[model samples]
Target: MIFILIVTLLIYAGLVFYVAWSGYRGIGIKGNRWFLIAYSIIMLFLSVSFILARFGSGSTLLAVIGNYWLALFSLSLMILPLVHLIMLILRLTSLHREKTRVAAARIAFVVLVAALAYGSYMAYTPKVNTYTIDIDKSYPEDLNVVMFSDTHFGYLSGKKHAERLVKEVNELEPDLIIIPGDIIDDDLEIVEKKQIFNILGGLEARLGVYGSLGNHDKFRGELSELITAIETANIEILYDETVTIEGGLALIGRKDYSEGERLATEQLTSQLDQSLPIILLDHQPYEYDEAEQAGVDLVVSGHTHRGQVMPGNLITNRLFENDWGYLKKGQLHTIVSSGYGFWGPPIRIGTQSEIVQIHINFNN
Candidate 1:
């Protein structure tokens, strides 16, 4: 962990320096040297503060301050690109009048900044995504399934986020809720355990909630304990097992790939009726081809978090057949959510946490 932290800090420091250099090159060394130095120092201090809070001796206050500073720094970083874009646009317009060009550039900058700020606010706000799937099953027509994954339930996702998630799930009037793993982080014992459970229990699902073992859940050695806790909260756990939902839909939960346990496709295949629709809840979406070949009608997964940072989604897409969002592989329908919580850094740079509402319709 210490070595990982050192490597991460070094990478972040390098990124900060690169951004500073880029900004200096754009504005010229003599013109914006002071601005570059100020921004660089701010970025370095914020990065160091956050790293210290995580690994070294630093208080929560320092971390909070660092987070705020980083948020401001992110805005400033956006400003650089927006400014350059505006200048380029003005230059293209053939506006020779210096005063007019400057005025127009200033207006464009303000508009761009305002738009970005609004976008950031909207991105932070909770958004519900609804999807419909026709599985030709005997499930109830109004049966709603609330699916949430990658709720890293630690520093970033606390009681408030869990409560909001519960409230949103309840609003969907779901009959069954599915959490495809990574429900909690490493510090589950020290984290907001009761509050998260309380909110989870408050969910109004008649068929109850189900969870699969995620990588983090296994890493923390809290797999059995978390299952017990969720079961105590009235949610059923299907670890490498299949549970029939009374409506011709078989929900199969598989352990994380890291568990070294082979995919439970054979086990589920033996138990599942060929006439019924089978939905496989696997944490990572990597092995969809096998799942599709195994006759899984739908596969729900998380784990990738859609590259929670910049270029992450692109990289993850390359690694997996379907890393984020929805994809149909032959006869299998696969949906990989970015997730309701974040991992590693609390800040989600390019991806937002999500809850997917899947409405299943039977074909007549």
Candidate 2:
């Protein structure tokens, strides 16, 4: 964890510095003293935000402010390199360069603002993606399963968001609902302040709404309360356990990797009737072979958030075999959600926030 923080700080700090230097050089020519003062103030704000947000007393509001600031700043960094490239070329060619640099800077700012605006809207507009899969099994009915992960009902969203989600899910009239984790981002204070738990209690599922833990749910060392809160909302935490739903299929929910894995996939599935179809709810895509070998029919997971933001999605795709969608290998199938909510930045660039609707049919 510390290593990750260190790396993030280092990288963000480097980007901040690069932005500062570029601004001083390019935009400074417009005005000297006022530009320097404004530049220093913005840098100070960003620096203070990073320091207090990470090392201070963990305020949700501060965290929220820091998140959007960092997000906008991060996206701005993407365009900075292009501006730098253009400036470099102008320097080399040395012909009408000042006007060109100013023009490039103006265009980049407009592009940055436009991108951020679009990303902001996309972040909140959660969409439902549908999938139809036929599992080879003899059963009496078709199972409509609604699965979503990373609701993250804390800072970016609140009780209204919870209510909206329940309404959306209930409208689908699902037999079962599965969540793969990250129901809340961090800090129970925000959860309590927003009454997110009570709002979430509104969720209704015929078979029951089942879920597993995610890293952020345990991030602030508040797993116990989060669990209590979830149970209070009538959402069952599966936590390395299995429950047979509607008398036909086994639903296995695994512990988040943050928590130690208590049982192997085989052990979890070993006691179940082999003839029945088995589905797994794991917060992350872990031990695929173990689940597949154990005769698990489908493994549902989220946590990659389909990279949540761009370029990051590229990294996520490389990290997981099925990072953002459905994949089938032999008899085992996997479905990963991009998630229904945003973390940190509350922005989705070149990615989406989504819920999965799976219509599963059994041959019998």
Worst 10 residues of 1 by lDDT: 115-124
Please estimate how well model 1 matches the true structure, expressed as its whole-model Cα lDDT: 0.72
Each model's TM-score, in the order given? 0.74, 0.92
Q: After superposition, how far is residue 324 of candidate 1 from its true place, in Å?
A: 2.7
lDDT of each: 0.72, 0.82
lDDT (tens digit, per residue) of candidate 2 on 170-261:
89998888898988876677787888888777877888988888887754655676788788888899888888777678888888877784
What digit string (tens of lDDT, one per residue) describes model 1 on residues 101-154?
456545645754574465344334556778887775555554577899988775
Clashes of each: 0, 0
- Estimate the Cα RMSD of every predicted model relative to the unseen true structure: 5.2, 2.3
Candidate 1, residue 153: Cα displacement in angstroms equals: 1.9
Candidate 1 off by > 4 Å = 1-10, 18-45, 52-123, 137-142, 218-222, 309-311, 344-352
